[model samples]
Target: MSTVHIKPVPVTPEEVIAVARDHARVVIDAEAREAMAASRAIVDAIEREGRPVYGVSTGFGALANTFVEPERRAELQHALIRSHAAGVGDPMPEEVVRAMMLLRVRSLAMGRSGVRPEIAEGLAALLNADITPWVPRHGSLGASGDLAPLAHCAMVLLGEGWVREADGSRVDAGPVLERAGLRPITLSSKEGLALINGTDGMLGMLILAVADLRHLLTMADVCAALSNEAMLGSDRPFQPELHEIRPQPGQAKSAANIHKLLQDSEVMDSHRNDLAHAVQDAYSMRCAPQVAGAARDVLAYAETVADQELRSVVDNPVVLPDGRVESTGNFHGAPLGYAADFLGIAATDVGSISERRVDRLLDITRNRGLPAFLSPDPGVNSGLMIAQYTAAGIVAENRRLSAPASVDSVPTSGMQEDHVSMGWAAACKLRTIIDNLGTLLAVEMLAATQGLQLRLPLIPSPAARAATAAVGPIAGKPGPDQFLAPVIEQVKRLIESPALRHEIEEAAGPLA
Candidate 1:
């Protein structure tokens, strides 16, 4: 496995995706270590001077007015970790936890969090050793920095929580740390607050969601093209000249992609000059680029937000190089919340449009000359009729999930922390929407391919042919339906597979 080196500078969303989803190893750079040391020196001076600092010498949130003696400061740090590790529900996925850890490390590496280099090194060791902490899925208000979830992560570093082994078994972190030749170090002044106070959790999930949505958006264009060809729809709407008039970058790109996919299509050529065909097709076939392209543009905006977030330092009472420690609101997750909610809305619309295309492929009247439901005997086999229902159900769920989580806020910490951002909620629901969209697109792919197969002697474009061939290995040619649930799942797998998209792109050239 390749390793991703973390420096003091900001990382790109693509780098986050590589480390989070690809399980890449992590190493902190020398510049980051130097920055961390410089920051820690400021914190040490504050502690020595016995001045009251929010997280260094004083208490936190509602308890900020309380003072702590130097002798018991370490105990304060330990208690903070124990009390805040109060998250509930099922543990988060391992990938999410790992991403959270990496982002936390990156934030501390900025040298603004007043954390020691050893602390950052310990996190890197945990990633390198594959010892994942069990972080719960709930209890984050996305203010004061995903406190509960990150505290659970810090618990593992303190040798007090569970760690997941490579085989997926949970064990005491103490023993695992010992086995890895690692020892849990005591937290110094502000170290505990620094560990738990950041937007890493929401940010990590947002980055991963952006990567998935990007791929799915491109695949949507391919599915739309396949549906256009299978339904004998004209490629005239996708011509560059037609799209240039409107000039939406994403819309133009989508039209270009569809045009390429339908290039050299015998099925389209066969009906090119037929005046008997309707002058225009239905909205589902004719306006696919406009709908899907709008979603693509929304995703582009979300990606921009993720990129800016990656470079930010998100912690409270951040240590400064000029030797001043000041409190700030960088930890608030509203930015991430808005981005996740926007993507959710986009995913819902994209899935909804894809479902409509699937419906068109099944209706005999609308599917042009294709058989009813694309089944040899429509009444007996039922064909893909229920698959559309499944897609519809998922699209409906996505719509509900698309409600903006940022708008809903509840006060926390004795009202000391009020107006919290539900960014974490937005991020979690966006993951579900992305998964649902993938399955919905998969159903469209199956129906579109079946429609193309029924066209018989008249072949689809090279791109559509490649798409159908990719599915052929996983889902056989159209006929009387067998156990369709498995076929839908198999085709879903193919739709999500990079190989399928690679094949289509190879035949049709690069898609936008």
Candidate 2:
């Protein structure tokens, strides 16, 4: 699909990923153009009127008291970038760097940061040419605008650093700019502060994380249904009318997805006979909707925060339309930081519940008709027993990692940057949790599929049947203790593929 054109309204996290992955071009809107013009006019007035603004005539951060002469202003901006480009860690993935460039362009397009037009243009050219800067993973408090990492970005604009070219070659920005016929930007007034001070880096990571999580959530519903069918658990918990009374959008949506994924199967309808072994199944099966639904709720709120961050001109000393410069704390990462941590907590639960289901599948007493290790030769061969151990270990790790990152802070920048959001920590940690959830889900699929195969002749719940149809041909049933790793790997790919992901999303839509 072609990328949607955005005006002044904030861009959603999903929109940011779609644009970057699909190579969308961003254009400045009329209002944004006027905002840019007003900012530029104020800057021109500063240069002409000889007004002493914080960053325009003075130094940055702890060096605010030192003043730069008018002749040295351009040199000062260049020096600011060179000195602050001290980010040290592994280089960020290429896609993330591209998303950062896209986000930086969108933020500048809002036109309130007093940056020159070429600054935004340079970013756009990089996006078009697929030039990704080698931004590092660490060294940001997620306040003061993700200083170290963003400085690396700004350094590329001056063509004084290095960037990854279209074909993955790292080239010096100076010669590349000369070859591309582009000029190095000279910072004017608040431009350096504008370029470096904002939540773009954290926001970019969150956007990609959220987009991938949305897909993973869809995969979770399908996997949960498969596990549900393998156990022949009652489907009474997912009645649409029951959820309709309270009507949280996410809860209602999850219940509906469960219903649709099981709609055509004979297995769900066949078990209407109330043979009371226990009145109902456990909470892991019964409360899947509630747990999964709550995550969706947090995701909705996080999307709002992500969108606002994308469009906001978050630099300090913002140029107001009335031609006044106001230094403020809009660059703080608290909102995005907390949201990322909340998302990690929410996503972590999906893995937690799925682990319980994996345990249930392996327990012969709990699993009813399935074999002790889910093996045909129960006593001799230990089949899928160890799979649960792997899932358990992953779930425990996720629990430890889900601790809130926003609650912690340390002083920096001579204590001026005291109470940072730690949003980068939140973003990176959440990315790990999401990946772990994927592997956990993959493990469950291997075990559940094995259990269903053992419970042959007796049909599975309707949702399980559909999931088997979706994944069975791709990964056939294992035999005689063969390497189950390939089966788990295959199921993970099926769960993650665009086709199966779309099917689950369609199932989720009716509840909305």
Candidate 1 regions exceeding 4 Å error are none
RMSD of each: 1.2, 2.6
Q: Which ten residues in a row have the lowest lDDT in candidate 2?
A: 503-512
lDDT of 1 by residue, 134-182 (tens): 8888989999989999998899899898887767677888998999898
The best candidate by TM-score is: 1
What TM-score does candidate 2 reach? 0.92
RMSD of candidate 1 to the truth, in angstroms, is 1.2
In candidate 2 the C-alpha lDDT for residue 492 amounts to: 75
Give one clash count per candidate, in the order shown: 0, 1
